[model samples]
Target: MNAYGSYVEFDRARWAALRSRTPLRLSEEELQRIKGLNDKISLQEVEEIYIPLTRLINLKVRAAQYLDEVTSAFLGCEPVHKPFIIGVAGSVAVGKSTVARLLQTLLSRWEHHPTVDLVTTDGFLYPTRVLEEKGLMARKGFPESYDTKKLLDFLTRVRAGERQVEAPVYSHVTYDVLPDRSEIVDSPDILIVEGVNVLQVSKGQPVFVSDFFDFSVYIDAEEQEIRNWYIDRFLLLHRTAFRDPSSYFHRYAELTEREAVERATNIWETINLLNLNENILPTRGRADLVLSKGPDHQIHRVFLKDL
Candidate 1:
């Protein structure tokens, strides 16, 4: 492995070699279904990158299980089962969601962990009304826009193996949290938590969100690449989702192509970029593993923390 600061860096080819003949478990259709709007992932990429990643995670899970059993036996107590939580964090358009979803799907297919669940921090974002009241509408994706206490409590209960724990649901179409709805998370064998702020450290909080993660990943790319992806995604949405009358961004559907580009660029610069620099990017070093992407959205390199 190539050494890179505190991490062991692996280029795409090297990282792919770690698959160790693991069979490709995902189909192209499935990959297409899970990829983000502007993200590019192929079955080849899955076989090379994600398959090996999941294999590594599987080994970790097995070790954790064995440790739990050994500790229980040593203490003359019954073994307690707890979900292995994985946190995936990144910037607005860095494709962390795609990675998280892929992990949930692949990890569940493994015989040892048949139950894998996925959750996004988007659900924990404050509602539009609350943000408006707090004067944080423009800062929606920033750390302050989240209900950290609620999120922490949710993770605490999940970690304790609480049954039927509920998390708030978020609607992308409305760009707000649904007050009347929630996601019930039954204790699964593995839980993948994905979001922009999952790795963030709260200054005054006694416990941070990352404390609940057994493993964490940061999806990385140059700032300019992410900015382009965000703009491209906005343009795609302008032609599609934003055209829906019920969409919160429907107003953008009326704009010309140039106007849409300008507006999207402005939002990216003024809000998402600031959030990335001030809150998100700083947490990159905190991740257990980091997947760095190329401009084409393919993960070109991986930086994994040494065990």
Candidate 2:
């Protein structure tokens, strides 16, 4: 229906020309890190989109903190504290992960905040064993494949002003959950929660993973472009990470190039694309902002609902 499969049509050049008043600063080191993911990281996009976004979120967080302080003072509390949670959601291979990581670094560097942390919803996915037990391997990214209750519990604890909470970590190399290990979610000035279905709303459930978010973002792109990106990233991984003996997907590396690409395409068409259409796409409207990307993978425009 639109360039990015959204109902809205946009012109990249015109949108890029819309001057943003937010300050954006990135050192060479920061640029290099972003380039590692894709060499096409433009300072203009960062300035026009992410910078304004960070400033808006910063203001919201500050307002939230102030209101919290007033409420605490009214109740005669000793201290007021809680991390601001920002949720990033999108289809697979939409580069939302890179955005989350970048924002975590950039926002933390702001003089107003001392710490920022990035946490992913991947860790909340049910383990391979559990998935197999429930016969949900084919539906891995589907809502039913996740431990929604545990995810809700973890978020509730995080929202309750808990000082520390542990989230399980998933190892792509091992293709399994690291049962004995966990990442400490120490309190921070802000927490970036990034994942495909983090913004999903299950109609039947009274609880949802997105309830914990203070702000949410949806990274949007056309389905064909997303599928293409997924295939390209898979091919890249096949040449690099999948070549490692420790890589769980190494089995595919032994195949001929044609075979490997075929398998990757099948997986993308069947699993990832299906999940995106059925589960993730429905949540775009729920985000506080939607970052619409062009076919070339650069952002075309941003849509923020009226406050």
Give the best candidate by lDDT.
1
TM-score of 1: 0.98
Evaluate all candidate structures by whole-model CA lDDT and list the values in order.
0.92, 0.80
Cα misplacement distance, residue 243 of candidate 2 (Å)? 1.0
lDDT of 2 by residue, 159-184 (tens): 77687799889897887788998888
Q: Write the per-residue lDDT of candidate 1 for residues 1-307, one digit (tens) a residue.
A: 4533589899999999999988888888888999989788988899888999999999999998899899999999988778999999999988988899999999999988989999999999988999999999989999999999899999999998888999898999999898899888898999999999899997778899999999999999999999999999999999999999999999899999999999999999999999999999999989999999998899999999987
Segments in model 1 whose C-alpha atoms lie over 4 Å from true places: 1-4
Global local distance difference test of model 2: 0.80
- All candidates: CA RMSD in angstroms? 1.4, 2.7
Error of 2 at 281 (Å): 0.2
How close to the true structure is residue 265 of candidate 1, measured as C-alpha lDDT?
95
RMSD of 2: 2.7
